[model samples]
Target: MNAIGIDELRGLAMLPPTASGHSPFAEPCLLLRLGGTAERRLADWLRQLPCPVIGIGEADAPLAASCDVVVQNEQEAQPLLAGVRRSPVAATVLVQLLRASESLPVADALTMESLAYATLQGGAEFRRWLEGRPAPPVPPAETGPAVLLAREADTLRLTLNRPARRNSMSVEMRDALVEALQLALADDDIRRVRIDGAGKCFSTGGELDEFGTAPDPATAHAVRSLTVPGRLLAACADRAEARVHGACIGSGIEFPAFAGRIVAAPDAWFQLPELQFGLIPGAGGCVSLPRRIGRQRTACMVLGGKRIDARTAKDWGLVDAIESSR
Candidate 1:
């Protein structure tokens, strides 16, 4: 199978929509026709294109040069199409292919046309874009410490690597965990997630070392008012799962509560000591936790700053179940 790196594809994919200004004789377009096996694949790559491309038989050879890339052979074309069927770039295939060829096979050509139209026109549809959301930004996978690896059968397992500071949620760890959770939500393979702290404790909370001087309240308010990630978390509320052990606190609880299920170790405890530091759960904990455990309970946990054991959490319905032991 022929494949192009995303970087190279980005560069090669910049062909213009129309070849009007260029020399009419110059070959600005390319034509692609695949044998039975590749019919779908050839159609798909064309669909991702921002410019239009026509089939060789439907239009004369003039449009073929406009095609920057084409699969001359059918067998090589199948996988590319199947892979791009659900992509946002699929819509641009026809924008990549102008009105040149009607002779193209009906089914594949129609599929390409539909994809092109959507990519070109679906920008204003908020939910459509959301449905095709991109991967969350995260750190490169290689650099971090390796710690606890949490896994459930057929579910997701995340290795909480930072064992040094009682597994406090370092910025790297937080961003990585968030990115991992987002990926799990997008993946059909992951049905549940297990979160365990490295070393002795489950978590001490956010990496206080990473917490800098607080941003100006006005600035913080302005950002929260916009509510970007919060809205995204709201949308993903029903899909993720978490299993926690040891000292789950602050952002530890905040992040996990977004999961659809929460299971903690028998000795594991829950707390939101953010109030003591004059802060609240900044990562949707204020909203998510209260919704699950209730306001009075959330208040007592946050304001009272008292620790609640796993069974107490189970009684309050904070956690779904307690693990048998460490």
Candidate 2:
């Protein structure tokens, strides 16, 4: 389509300008467009407009809800983001497309209102569009040794090796951890599993990068893998050890809480901010955390979404030992 053909986008308008001398972008539209000449033309138009136009770059589409216009096109869909540095667009809308041209005006594509509902309003309107999209499965590459392995006849040492992404638990890491835990559980020679991080923080909890793109079925599968192993680990809750520091949040706290003993540095802070993300403790934490700290305290910690110092964690019956290294 020609760059001038983009004027048709005016027909997809959802909001009218509140005042004269105002361009629609002043009342901005979250624009979703495939990267190409058309996208560049739209971007140029948006730049000249009198308001905020949110440009959703191809990769940052998850944050598209905050924008007003979303454009999709193949010609401008290249990953090499341009005009992004040039627009007053509140955000850009980029749909994942292959072969660049697939992003061209297709009859079977998302609508502006639907985009607003699914992304801007954070509703399920995009669920149908997302139904078939899923990350291809990894080849089960060996990421590291089993998290729990017998170092001595009576002692097991478990280390989370993903120090790069703040030790965020990827699907691969979760699976590896599960396999490690299973091996540890089956070994008659092992007595205690000592869990610690390889770097600064113990863990930042679940990986959210895959949130919108992860198909519900795969997400469910991942959830089962993450929590089932967590349940099993919690079940083997005898004389386990946790050496933690830095920000321990959500599943981080949930996982460490399951240890028979939790050792936190004096500077360590524990928190559960799942409520902020519209989720509950999925790692058997609703039962496990409450069992340790009581339902009232669990509610306080989760609902409050506040930092719980080491002393507070100890006082709430959440932690067992405070490390001296802080």
Candidate 3:
């Protein structure tokens, strides 16, 4: 992908807005040439343009704050813009970043920007894959308990137990998790709550077979907002810890991020592939991930569709510690 030049960027800004209020450039990205001083009018225009703007040149705190991304020079801007231009939803993600910036904290704005990009990129890829592809057969729902409970001393240990599906977070699993958290919260004797998963991998995220099976978007939203364990874990974060191993995808990483401490095995790897399905991180990842690593890195992980190893996860402050695999 070619780096968007200054002249091209200016032309894009001059173009008429779409009926839905978006830029003309299908993959709009602004390369702002910021010298020593802050350009207020330029900044205002950049903000209004529906695309991610990268301010290249001298560092100006105020000016930097206004732009979605800032770099030292054209060289730095090239790779970043190349990556952005490759995303099918680059323009849409920029628009979302601008809106999120207005009301959210700086960290949150960055996080949202990354998520928006990831969502669009993922969604587009998913659609492409679906084209001419036969619908996959849905597996029969697993029976028996989805969560296993064990008491040790003053700690309540909850293990996700559907190994057949690699402990995918089925609705039953989510409900069971919430129930166990509630139980632990109610008992003063339970001073701590430990969460882990059974089988080869911790989890592969929410049940793929169950996607779009919800009666309606509103109902799904209600279940996610009201009943998901992400919220419960957050409320009692200080008393909660997660021991994660193997692949921790999407909600697997999102939920554990809320725990006061997250311990990852040496072989553990993390990813957020929700956007690949044309969706945001619905499992409180929008909140938890950004809080842990800041938005820029989160965006890279989500938008790049990259898997982060335990070492990288630790360096980014996503996991509190990494333990040697047994």
Q: State every prediction's TM-score relative to the real structure.
A: 0.49, 0.54, 0.75
The whole-model C-alpha lDDT of candidate 1 against the native structure comes to 0.50
The digit string of per-residue lDDT tens for model 3 on 189-302 reads 998999999988899898876666666555555455557687778778899999999999988898888899999999999998654564556666666787898655565565
Model 3 poorest ten-residue lDDT run:
16-25
lDDT of 2: 0.51
When 1 and 2 are scored with lDDT, the better candidate is 2
- Ordered list by TM-score, greatest first: 3, 2, 1
- Tens-digit lDDT track of model 2 for 102-201: 2332211212212221332232323332354465444233455525344866787778777666676666667776777777678777788888876688
Q: Write candidate 1's Cα lDDT for 1-326 as tens digits.
A: 23333333334435542422211123223324422222233334444444223232221232233343233443433422332232313212322332222334323333333333333333333235434445434433344544344456656677677665666776556556656666666777766555556566677776654443234434433443343233334445565456788788886776677666788888788887653332445555555665577533453454346688999988988888887654
The local lDDT score (0 to 100) that residue 11 gets in candidate 1 is 41
The whole-model lDDT of each prediction reads: 0.50, 0.51, 0.69
Reference-based lDDT, residue 205, model 3: 94
Error of 1 at 69 (Å): 66
lDDT of 1 at 84: 26
